[model samples]
Target: MELSPRGVNMKRAFIVPAIMVLFFSGCGKDKNEGGKTSPPQAKSESAAKSGGEKAQMPSRLQQAVKEGRISEEQARQIMARRAGGGDKPLVRLGTAARGEIRTHLVLNGTVEPERSVDVYARLSAYVQEVVREEGNRVREKDILARLDDTEIRISHQQAKIQLEQARLTLEEEKNNHQRNQELKENELISDMDFQASEARYRQSRLEFENKTENFKNLELQLNYTRIRAPVSGFVTQRLIEVGDRVTANQHVYTVEDFSPLLIRVFVPAADINKLQAGMNAEISSDTLPGRTFTGHIKLINPRIDVQSGTVKVTIEVNDSSLTLKPGMFVEVNIVTRSREDALVIPRTAVLYQRDQVLVFRFREGKAVAAPVSVGVTEDDRVEIVEGLEEGDTIIIQGAEMLKDGVEVSVLK
Candidate 1:
């Protein structure tokens, strides 16, 4: 301990090499003790074989948790996701209910009044008074607007005076002709003078008839100053106002009958045979949601359009509440066929594969595909004619990746 610095360094080096050699020798002795390998080495080989056998299973999930590769909760989740546990396709189910179903053709068209009349002015005159404005309800012959009748009335009065004067002159001529005839028959005057008097009386009679017709013409012209509604409906348009001059046959107002509206839809020629003049139709509008108006086929055009290959069909709507109006674009569903008390299901539940129609029926928490024969299809519903019964639960969603006997979790 008290040696020089060089002597102390040499002694420490010799003791460090001897200690390392003894440590290595002891490790070798433990590895081959009693002609057997160490316990840790044997355990590692056994684990490798066991891991290969259960690699695809969750048997090693707990070992992964112990090794800090995963959490304890994650290990439980992995085990739970195996077969005979919570692993299943999530799906929504719908019941096949017995109800009315129909086959229809959908089309879009503009709403028009059953009877839309354009009120026209018969005489050219300046509008004097506006009796009814737009949106005013009117009946047949209701005055919509009044025109200036000053000139017409004055002419009417003058014609009346002329008619009266002609009537007086005609009466005098008749008396004179009678007197002249008596004289001519009795030979109390010359033949030429009597003939001349007869001519004068005939001319006066002709003048009176002309004046009577002229007076009636003027009276009719005076009545034409008032523009009247031609039909009973709501006034939809007012083209004339106070001091607006309107001519003969000029459009002044538009009256539309909303009690029963009209919708003209052009249907394809292929579907023309299925339609008739009295088929039931359901009408709906985007502007008015959740409301359905009823109607029927009023007429179907016999001629088909050569260019478009579509036939024109007119629908007459029965809207007692006046909820529908003219010019509203609406969707029309013309029912071609219907079935009552038929088993129907959501259309999305059906799967079309080749020529067969299939649906996934939920039974015993599994998806079972069944072939179905469908009939009339209306909107999002289809009639189940075969292979399904009422009150059966079928998969409505999340069945795209499902196979036969595959487990499912039905959603509420």
Candidate 2:
């Protein structure tokens, strides 16, 4: 083609523009990343609308969208929300229940021996009596069983006779000495003879004293033929049968002291001040299902546990009806302090976090953190001393997955 240089250049440039236009045309397209989603759908809708993401948006952005316009920060908030943002950072919640606030302690404890004594027979005798069987109830001085008193009584009688004989012999010696002294004064007997009589009489008196002691001891032994309960309680062990012979200090039966049964509990050192002697407790256990036993604090250990950081608290329960036995694993609820009109919330509403306590309250439709001073937490309710007003809306279910100021779908 016949061409001028300038016109040729112009034609080349026009062709290049046409090619560039064709090449760049697809670059601005709203591609379906997959036909299921629109890359521009989210962005384009956001340009004209408040907060364009259909799924989620932050509280500030949601507000702006309601007002028909949003700031750049609001738009950023929408993007962040779309990427899984929520109000109230990951926390836990429980019910904010209204009730009395009572200080309590959670402890691990064990049952112990309450002055258990293995009965021993102090006198040697054949068990001639069977008064109490195993697990039988006995009282102090109550005869548990008896031993053969025939031998004991005979020994006692013999000792008593000997004691009387010794006393009579000593008396006769004294009478003779008195008369002999009178004879010596009259020079009717030699001095050596008088002295000899007196010596003999003194020796007999000493022997008599020894015999008297032996007699009393023997009599006491005779009384031991009747086995008596040292203290009142149910009999646990009975080693002797009806005819079994028992020697001195031999095991016969076992008795337990159960005037008021003792219960031991451990409490945290931080809450030790709340615990006191004579505090009321409610005891329960899996073994004794559906049964709650009431008890009172009998002792509070003066020392704190260094290793476990707990204090030992003891409660005494009345098991006189024989229903509660020793060594049963139980749950003891110790009431240290209580308030009839204390501000309390749900224990679940307050997150039991490590090192501190946290609560998430819905403030003006946004979740905000509320640091709390936790008091008595009984069952599902807890005492909130700080950081919340009465009747505040606290998130119970969704607090664990929320961030501050994020949009929340309240559960009504």
Off by over 4 Å in 1: 1-85, 88-97, 360-369, 389-399, 405-412
| Candidate 1 pairs with clashing backbones | none
User: Which 10-residue window in model 1 sums to the lowest lDDT?
Assistant: 76-85
How far out, in Å, is residue 219 in model 2? 1.9
Give me the candidate number with maximum TM-score. Answer: 1
The digit string of per-residue lDDT tens for model 2 on 1-412 reads: 7999999999998899898898898565555657444556686666646544454665755665565443456465546544555542332233454567776665545555466877889877788878998788788889998889887788888998999899999999999999999999999999999999999899999999999999888788877888888988878888888878789989898888776777787888888887767778888777778988788888888999889998888888876575677777788877767888777876546676687778888766677777888776677677887777777778764465566566565542
lDDT of each residue in 209-327, candidate 1, tens digit only? 99999999989988898788888989999988798888999888899888788999999999999999999889999899999988999999999999999999999997878888888
Highest lDDT model number: 1
The 10-residue segment with the lowest total lDDT in model 2: 87-96
Tell me model 2's lDDT, rounded to 2 decimals: 0.75
